[model samples]
Target: MKYTTDDVHNRVKKILYGLTGITLADNKDIMISNRIDKLKRDSKYKGDIMDLLHLVEEGSYVTEFINSFTTNKTHFFREDFHFLDLKNRAIPQLAKSGNKINMYCSASSTGEEPYSMAMTLLEVQDEIGKKLNASVIATDIDTNVLQYAANGVYRYSKSSKEFPEWIKPSKYFKRRIEKNLAGEEILIKVKDELKKMLTFQVMNLNDNTYPFSKNQFDIVFCRNVLIYFSAEDQNKILKKLFSHLKIGGTLYLGHSENPQDLVNYVKRVGQNIFIKEKEAF
Candidate 1:
């Protein structure tokens, strides 16, 4: 019952790695400890930290344990280039071919990214005057974030932290401004159209097999998540994402992510954007 901080930290680190495949450096003691403390307090677990750790090891709070360590930071329209391609290229190609447009947000986070994708798809559909059936599959490893994402309400402020700088509330959100203790807080709720276009699920990219059919997606956004993985994992995920993507489907990575291993399988079409080559299989 009296486990040291080191004992708690090491067990947590191992559990996080086993469940999510995210490696935590030993120097992340403060982060691990802080998160564990928060989990104990928030989970309302009567036992001490070690007891909670033991529960996690035996799979009681595995989801919460994994959620504690996984970073879920995301933004709407975080990168303009990706959406621009969706608006200008992918949507148009699919529309003209009379094919249903499908997209996957591999790291959808709290829904901003997938909501952004939905907005673009709908806008493109409207502009082209096509009745293209379009939908987005949003998946995240963290159930907590996924719940928030599915709820789709936010406290909008001047800061770019919660809301994006360029998203127009008139287009995709039901705007409501109210004065709270913190002063005038703009609460933007996602429109029903955007909400209906997305389906969120819990997923771990580390899994060898995914619950998707081969060549099912026209575009996939695995952005910013690849950097957290090892080199071998990055390659494995890339290959899997490519396999799930249709020939000529698009893949978006983070700006800082190095995807040199995919040089043979994809063609670089834009900044951090790659089009799955037909020869990729």
Candidate 2:
């Protein structure tokens, strides 16, 4: 059955608002219809459009629907320059400050960004060794992806091939001795040293209560996740992120995201990078 663009928009608006507390406006007709068509094809729904809408409207299925519609296109070192900045400037500066350094990867999907962060810290291990305490908390809303992240393994053929060999799991991780019931080999082993520095958890940015402390982090990498949020939500999240950073902590956004004249506490540093003003805390 065919759906008018309005039907698609109404259905999707209800679904998104229920699942994410996000309201997709009525103007999003074409985009919503396109997304629903894709979802229909992906889920193999053989019935009418109304039936598909029913599936989406059922609140129990919204999480899977959100994951299906959301984009998760990250790879090892997708933002290469940020790592360079982290190595040359961020970590070095933090080392001398005599503070425990906590960095958060707020939208870490599939583990590449946080693991890449671990690798960068290892590169500067000699200078940063024991001078600065470090911990990385990687959070995402999708539990399926979080499991993959917690496992710290990837299909080397997809995202890891372009990374230098020294950072690949082969340099550190040994193949796990156990197999899933499928009897297929799992493809990763994170070195004990790097693995110790990172943790993965499920966090929903839309929630009113954050699980972390205020003024607690030295840096946060919440990239590529804000594009889906409305401007109002983005502003709210920026404020929340700022509240969690120390006086001079830094916040990194995706190349496509901007603070839109909303934040005064963070000053532009490098491209797509912002440093919290020393006075903000």
Best candidate (score: lDDT): 1
Instruction: For model 2, name the residue pairs that clash.
Output: 173-189
Per-model TM-score, in order, reads 0.92, 0.79
- Which runs in model 2 stand beyond 4 Å of their true positions? 1-5, 21-58, 127-132, 158-161, 164-169, 175-186, 278-281
lDDT of 1 by residue, 1-281 (tens): 47677887888877877787787777888888788876776677887777787888887977767777888777878877788888888778888878788899998899989988888888777887877788899999989999999999976765665334444667788878998797788888988978998999999999988899999999999888887777887888888888889888888888887556678878888898888887454
lDDT of each: 0.82, 0.75
Model 1 pairs in collision: none
RMSD of each: 2.2, 4.4
lDDT of 2 by residue, 1-281 (tens): 66676766676776775566566665766667677777677667777767776877764455556766555779887778788888889988887866777899999988889988877777766655654578899998877688888887665444346475345456556665456786755566677887889999988888876899988888899898888788888877777777788777778899999865435767888989888885443
